[model samples]
Every structure is written in structure tokens, then in C-alpha cells.
Target: MNKKPNILLIYTGGTIGMIRDFKTGALKAFDFKNLLEKIPELQLLDCNIDTVSFNEPIDSSNMKPEYWVQMAEIIEDNYTLFDGFVILHGSDTMSYSASALSFMLENLAKPVIFTGSQLPIGDLRTDAKENLITSIQIASKQENHKPLIKEVCLYFEYKLYRGNRTTKINAEHFQAFASLNYPDLAESGVHLKINKEYLFRSSLNKNLIVRKNLDSNIAIIKIFPGISPQVFQSIFNIKNLKAVIIETYGAGNCTTEAWFINLITQTIKKGIHIINITQCSGGSVIMGHYETSRELIKAGVISGKDITTEAAIAKTMYLLGQNISGKSFKTIYETSLRGEIT
Candidate 1:
């Protein structure tokens, strides 16, 4: 007989982890120790469950690399004991955190599902119960006596998305996230239907590697009309800046003005990597497709392809931390490392 998979629920703080006092009507963090009592339906699941939480719950806006490291450490410490992990994080920065973890937890061969709700768990019409419950169920799913999902993912509303490919698109709706360039890995309705072909299956031969060294010496230059040379130049002057992500216009096109081109050229020559990514929410950056962007190609700017800004930042920081440099950095940055791009 197959043993029930052990699932670990890591509450890192978010609306989903809160409950209203009912009498005082004040919101407070929900105690995961009594998770079963609060959400008794969890007992119906086939898996054994456990819970862990941050020492002090933080608002997702305050999320940092250190918190990412803490999350990775929790997963590492319990990697052998649990078959899967579910992280409850604030929706505002959930994509960024999920993207960072996708790169940090190398050779991941089990599901790390991130999820949260638009409303508190104690609200009259809260979405937390459904999201949290389904996430745990997804984490416990198995095939051939092995985990069915083997990569980082985010579940919200009824859609499951590759973590690195997702972006929070709505602020006041139940469907708070989307994967513009990738398909949903699974969906919940009458039945839980998983798109098996879209699942990421890493090779199981290698050991799970938790990379803690993440460099944050990076900046973003979101190109806009009326942006001045002085402003752009000042970003390059930030101390110890190692890389910059330029959110370029459609297809990675930018100003053809000589001043703009020269500044980009100079930045690249200084060994500061510049990545050209599309500002459009749903398309890939086709560098050199237009005359305006040709100079960027000539200046050796890295292409972010279809990666989201959140993933771009995470990927750049992860690579920079690994001490990858020169042409090697550009090459790897342009390539998809965690199913983040096409």
C-alpha cells in the first residue's frame, strides 16, 4: 500500500493567514497549530499534514532576500520529512517571492505551491478556505508512488501556474494572478484536472540544492517617454550596481537618439549587464527586430525574452550571486533556467 504523502504548510504571513475577532472585528494572524480545528475539512485529505511559520509574520511588501533564504531553509530542513510544501504569502509580492524561490531551490523534485487569498479567512465570503484547501490537495497528489508535481508553482482562484511565469494582475478580484506567456498547469472545477504535459519534471538523480547567496545589487530602468539622460545616467551611478533591467517598449525597441544609445553602450562597456525586456504584459522581447533596438544588440544587451519583471530581477540576482560573469552571464540570462520563458 502507498503511504500518505506528508505535506508541510509554511505560513509566511498574508491575508489568508488572518481572521477577524468577530466580536472586536479586528484582524489577526490565524494560528496554524489549530489549523485543523479552524479548517476541519483538511482532515478529509489523504495526506499527513504539518505546519511551520515565520517567527513574526511579515507583510509581503517587507519581503526580502533574507526571508527568501529563511523559506528555503525551512524547506531544506524538512525536505526529507515532507513530500511537498505550501507557502502562504501576501498577494502583492507573491510573484517575486515565488520567482526567487524557483531559482533558489535548485533541482527541486516536489511541489512547492504558493497561495493566498484576496480576503481574510474569517470573512463571510472569504476565498482563503478554497485556495488553501486545494493547494494542500494538489501538493498531496501522486503518480506511480512519486510526487506528480516536481517544480515551484502558484495556485490562486482555480488556476495553477508555474511560479516564475506568473504575475499578480488584479488587486481587488479573486483571480489575482496570471501567467501571460505560459499555460495554466492545472485547474479546479467539477474535478481537479492537471495538464500533465505542462508540469515541470526535473531529473531526480541530483540532490536538492538550496542556494542562499542572492545578490541584490541591481536596478530597473523602465523606459518611458520624456525620460531624461540625467535620470538614466544617475541609475547607472548607483554604488555597486551590477545589473539593470530595462523595460523597453514593444519588441524591446528603445529611443534611437544617439544620447540614449551611447548611454546604454557605455553602461554595457563598464561590465554592468543590461537586460532588455518588453514592458508589455504579454509578449516576448525580440531584440533587433526594429532599427531602434539594433544598437542594443550591438551593445551586447541581454534579452529577457518573455520573462516577467519579477522573474527577471530574481534571475539576475540569482546569477549575479553565483558569480557568473561576462558572455556567460548574458548567455544564461537569455536562456530559460526554470521554465520561466519560452
Candidate 2:
């Protein structure tokens, strides 16, 4: 018989870790050490599970680069000891965390799944239990004693999505996320069916390497109708800004106005990397394909292709951390690093 997989459950803080006080109707942190007590269903899985919680739980809104580094460190420290890892985090920024981790962990050969619940676990009708249980199952899945998934993924609402391609689309619904440009990695229904063709195939000989340095000195500028040149210039001219993600119109088209083109050109000349991504959810960025976007391409803006905004930001930070030059940075940004873009 094959040895059962060892799964690490890292609870960073979210509704999944909460339990309601019946009398006071207050939600409090449930001790994960007694995981079985809260979710006895976990014992049903054919794997050994261990739990870890942050010393101080944080809301997703406060998640930062330092936290991403800490998460990477934890996985790095425990890389060889476990078969897979499931992170319980707030859904508000789960995509950002998952996307950041995708870039941080290179040559990953085991599943690193992030999951969280929209409702508290203590609630009778909460989605927490299913999300948590399935995430663990997907992480522990193996074929020929090798991990079935070898990349960062997010499991929610019976669907497993590529971490970097996902975006949180709803706050009230259980289906809070959608991978606008990528297909679902796996879906849970009568049985857990993985789209093996879509799975990331890592170079088996490569050892896992964790990237620690991340540049948070980046900004996102979303273009809108009647946007003022002063406002655009102010953002583009931020001091020490290393990168900017310009959310452009459909098919990566933007204003053909002279001032806008001048600002972009000047920004690029100053060594500030600019990435042009689509504002629409379901399309790829096609820079220079349209007359409106011709100026942006001429101004040296990098095309983000089909990358989600979350992934674009993470990719920029990852590339900036490498300290590459402007010309090379654009080349790397346009390429697919971890299935974040086409």
C-alpha cells in the first residue's frame, strides 16, 4: 500500500477559522489544534493533516508583501515534510495572495491551494466546510506516488481555478471568484475531475526555489471617461514608482490624445515599466491592433495579454524584485511566467 500524503493546513485568518458563540452571537477564532472537534469530516480524508495559524490573524485588507514573504518562508521551511499545503485566507484578497505566491515559489512540485469561506464555519448553512474539505482533498491527490497538482490553485464553490488567473467578482455570493481568461483547473461534483491538460508541467529535475524579495513600490491606474491629464500625470509621475498597471479599454485600447501619449512616453523614458491590460473581464490585451492602442505600443507600454489585474500586479512585483532593466522587463512581462497569461 502507498503511504498516505501529509497535508499542511495553514490558517492565516478568515471566516473559515471562526465559530459563533451561541448565546452572544459573536464569532471568535476557533482553535485549529482541535480541528476535528470543529469539522470532524476532515478525519474522513485518507491523509494525515497538521494545522498552523498565524500568531496574529489579519484581515485580507491588511495583507501585504511581508505577509506574502512569511507564507513563502513557511512553505519553504516545510517543503519536503509535506505532500501539499492548503492555506485558509480571507477571500477578499485571496487572489492577490495566491497570485503573489505563484511568483514567489518557483519550480513548485506539489499543490499549494488557497481557500476561504464567505460565511463563518459556525453557521449551519456556511460554505466553509465544503471549501476546506475539498481543498485538502485536491492538495492530497497523487498519481503514481507523485502529486497531481504542482502549482498554486484556489478552490471555492466547487471549482478549482488557477490562482493567478482568478479575480474576486462577488462579495455576497458563494461563487466569489472567476478566472476570466483561464479555464477551471478542477471542478467538484459527483467526483473531483481535474483538467490534466491545463495542469502546469514543471521541469522535474529542478529544485524548488523560493523568491523572497518583492517590490511593493507599484501602482495601478484605471482609465475612465473624461479622465483628467493632470490626474493621469500625477499617478504616472509618482516618485520612485517602479511599475504601473494601466487598465485600458477593450482589447487594450486607450486614448489617442496627444497629452496621454506624451505622458506615457515620458513615463517609459523615466524607466517606469508600464503594462497595458484590459479593463474587461474576458478578453486578452491586443496592443497595437487597434488605432486607439497604437500610441500606447509606440510609447513602449508592455502588453499584459490575458493576465488578470491581480496577476499583473504580482508579476510586476516579481519582475521588479529581479532588478531587470526596462527593455528586458517588458519582454518578461509579456511572457507567461506561471500560467497567469496566455
Candidate 3:
């Protein structure tokens, strides 16, 4: 007889956890301890569900590294007890948290699915029920007695995306995120379909390792026409800055102006690693592909190559926390580990 999967639902706060009061029309947190009463559909799944909520639920805008650490700790503490985890988080910072967690949890052998909805769970036409239900189902999915997904992923609307590869592109629509460079791991429709070819394969021999320390001394500089030297110099002057992400033009092209080139070169020389990513939504950064980008290559800027800004920031923090030397930081940034970059 097959044992039903045990899935843990971590409610970290968001629209999906909200229930509207009919009398006041104000939304408030719904206790997940009684989740089955709120969403009876959960009873249909052949899985044992458990719930954990933050002591104090926070708005997504208030999300920080400390919250991420807490989430990781929860997963690590319950790593062996649960077959999978489904995180209910706000859409605003969901991508960032998901991306950071992807790097923090190493050698993951079970699914960690993040999801949220656009409306309160109590609303008659709310999307919360479906999003939450599907997320839990995906987390519990198994084949041949082995978990199908073994990585951190975001299941929003109807698509499953590599957590680090996703970016929140919509504020009001049901589809809140898009993985521009990578393909979807699964798509829900009349039937729940898994794109097995796109799913990450994990090594059964390696145990999951959680990284708790994250260096937050990083900044992003989006290059723009008519950007002044003073503005550029100010960002480079941030005291004790560890890394900077330069959002460049097409294919990582930036101003070939002497002042801009010299500024970046000087920053690189100062041991501040600069990563050059394309500002375009869906394209890889090809350093030296054009005259405009030639000087960036000469200046020793690392190509971000289709990585979203959210993932780039998380990767920088993760690598910086490792205290890697300046000589190897560029190499690590350019390499793809969690499919964050092409």
C-alpha cells in the first residue's frame, strides 16, 4: 500500500490567507489550522496536510532577509518530516523570496512550491482557492514512489516556473509572474501536465544543506541616456559596497563614453564586482557583441546573460555571504546554478 504524502503548508502572509468579513467588508487573516473548513476541496487530495503560520504576518513590501532566514529555518527543521512544502506568500515579493530560497537550499530532493492569489480567499470569485489547492497538489505529486519536482518553484495562475528564473510582471492580473528566459516546468489545464524535460533532476545521494547567512550590501544601477557622472559616481561611492548590478542596454551594451567606462573600470579595480544584465525583458547579455559593449568587456564587467534582476540580487548576496575572493566572483556570477541565467 502506498503511504499518502505528507505536505506542509507554510502561510507567511498574503492575499491568499485573507478572509473577508461580510459585516464590515474588511479582510483579515484566516486561521490555517482550520484550513479544511475554509477550503473543503483540500479534503479531496490524498495527502496529510499540516499548517504553520508566522507569529506576525507581514505585508510583502516589508519582506526582508530575516524573514527569508526564518522560512529556511522552518523548512530545515521539518525537512525530514514532510514530503513537500507549499508556501503562501504575497505576490509583491514572492519572486525575490523564492529566488533567494532557491540558492539558500542546496541539494534539495523534494518540492518547495510558492504561491499566492490576487483576491481574498473568502470572495466568491476569488482565485485563492484554486491557487492554494493546486500548489498543495503539485507539492504532493509523486511518480514511481519518488517526488517529481526537487527544486524551489513558483506555481502562480496555472504555470510552474523555476523560482530564480521568474519575475513579477503583473500587478493586477491573475498571472503575476513570467519566466522570460526559461521554459515552464508544468502547466495546469484540463489535466495537470508536467514538462519532465524542463524539471530539475536532483542527486539522491546528496543531503539538503541550508545557507543562513546572506550579505545584503548590494545595489542595482540601471543605465540610462543622459545619466550624469555625479549620479554614477554616487552609487560607486556607497561605503563598503560588495556588489552592483548594472542594467545595461541591449545585449548588455552601455555608454562607451570615457567617463562611464572609466568609472566602471575604477569600481572593478576597487574589488567591487559589477554584473552587466540586459534591461530588456527577454534577452541574454552578450558582452563584446557590439561596439557599445566592447568597453564593458574590457572593463571586466561580468555578463548576467538573461538573468532577472531579482535573481541577480539574490545570487550576489548568496555568493558574497560565502566570502569568495574578487578574482573568482565574476566567474561564479556568470555560471548558471539554479537556471537563473542562460
Candidate 4:
């Protein structure tokens, strides 16, 4: 008989990690040591489950590069002991965290599934149970004694998405996340469905390389009808700013005004990488597709292609952390390293 996969459940704090106390009538952090007691269905999975909680769990809103490093360290330290990891996180910033992890855990050959819920674990109508249970199942799935999943992913509302491709699109609904530019990697329904073709596979021979030094010296500027030169000058003039992601209009199009083009050209000349990504959530940024975006192309703005803004930020930080040369930054950013861009 085959030995069951060992799964590590990391509770990083979120609505899913809270339970209602009947006596006090207030939500409190659920004791993950009693996880099996809270959700006995986990007992039915064909895996050995273990639990780890943050010393002081934090809301996803408070998640930062340091927290991401903590998560990566946990995975690195126990990588040999666990076949997979399932993180319980908040829905609000889950995509950002997930995207950051995808870049941090380089050459990852095991599943790192991030999941959360629109409701608390103790709620009568909680979606947490299903999400948590199915994520573990997906993570533990094996073929010929090897793990089935080989990359970081996000599981929510029965859909499995490539972590970096996902974005939180809804706050008040059960389906809080969406991967608009990419197809679902897997789905959970009557039977858990794995779209094998869509899955990201890594080489087995290479060891996992954890990237801890993520540079957060980046800013995002969204173009609006009346965005002034003063506003643009202030942002570009920020001290030690490494990169800026411009959320331009449709297909990476922006104003053709001389001042706007000159500012972007000057910024790129000063060694600060300027990335052009579309403001629309569902489409790729086709730079220079129209006359409006031509100046951006001429000014040497790197195109983000189909990358989500969250992923763009994470990717930029990760690349900058590597001390990638200014000459190679644009070339590398336009290339998809973690399948983040199509």
C-alpha cells in the first residue's frame, strides 16, 4: 500500500481562521491545534495533516514582504517533510500574497495551495470547509508516487487558479477571486476535476530556491482624465523609487501629450523601470497597438502584457531584489518567469 502524503496546514489568519464563541458572541482565532475537531472531514482525506499558526496571526491587509519571507522559510525548513502546503489566508489580499509566493518559491516542485473563504469557519453557511478540504485533497493528489501539482496556486469557490494570474474581483460575494487573463487550472465539483494541460509543472531534478529579499520600493499610478503634471512629478520624484507600474487605458494606451511622454522618457532614463499594464482586469496590455501607446513604446516603457497589477508589483519587487541590471530589467520583466504573463 502507498503511504499517504503529509500535508502542512499553515494558518496565517483570515476570516476562515475565526470561530464564533457561543458564550461571548464574538469571533476569535480558531485554535488550529484542534483543527481536526473543528472540521472532522479533514480526517477523511488520505493524508497525514499537520498544523502551524503564526505566533500572532495577522490580517491579510497587514501582510507584507517579511510575512511572505516567514511563509517561505516555513516551507523551506519542512519542504522535505511535507508533500504539500495549504495556507489559510484572508480573501482581500490573498492574490497579492499568492502572487508574491509564486515568485519567491523558485523551482517549486510541490503544491503550495492558498485558500480562504467569504465566511468564517464557524459560520452556518461558511464556504471555508469546502475550500479548505478540497485544497488539501488537490495538494495531496499523486501520480506514480509523485505529486500532481508543482506550483503555487489559489483555490476558491471551487476554482483553482495560477496564483499570479488571479485578482480579487468581489468583496461581498462567495466568488471573491477571478483569473480573467488565464484559464482555470482545476475545479472542484461532484468530482474534483484537474485540467492537466493547464497545470504548471517544474523540473524534478532542481531543488527549491527560496528568494527572501523582495524589494518593495515600487509604486503604482493609475491614469485618469485629469491627472496633473504635478501629481506625476511628485510620484516620480519619490526618493529611492525603483520602479513604477502605470495602469494605462485600454491596451496600455495613455495620453499622447508631450509632457506625459517626456516624463516617462525621463523616468526610464533615470534607471527607474516603467511598466505599462492595462487598467482592465480581463485583457492583456498590447503596447503600441494604437497611436496613443506609441509614445510609451518609444519612451522604452516595458510592457506588462497580460499580467495583473498585483503580480506585476510582486514580479518587479522580486526581480529588483535579484539586483537585475538596468540593461536587462526590461527584457526580463517582459518575459514570463512564473507563467504570470501569457
lDDT of 1 by residue, 37-100 (tens): 9899999999999999999999999999999999999999999999999999999999999999
Tens digit of per-residue lDDT, candidate 4, span 14-121: 999999887988999999999998799999999999999999999999999999999999999999999999999999889999999999999999999999999889
Estimate every model's Cα lDDT from 0 to 1: 0.95, 0.92, 0.91, 0.94
Instruction: Show the colliding residue pairs in model 4.
Output: none
lDDT of 2 by residue, 73-121 (tens): 8899999999999999999999999999999999999999999999999
In order of listing, the candidates' clash counts read 0, 0, 0, 0
Which window of ten consecutive residues has the lowest lDDT sum in model 4?
A: 198-207
For candidate 4, what's the RMSD?
Answer: 0.7
Cα misplacement distance, residue 156 of candidate 4 (Å): 0.6
lDDT of 3 at 217: 95
lDDT score for candidate 3 against the true structure: 0.91
> Whose lDDT is greatest here?
1
**Which 10-residue window in model 2 sums to the lowest lDDT?**
231-240
**lDDT for predicted candidate 4 compared with the true structure:** 0.94
Q: What clash pairs does model 3 have? A: none
- Model 1 ranges with Cα > 4 A deviation: none
TM-score, cand. 2 vs. native: 0.99
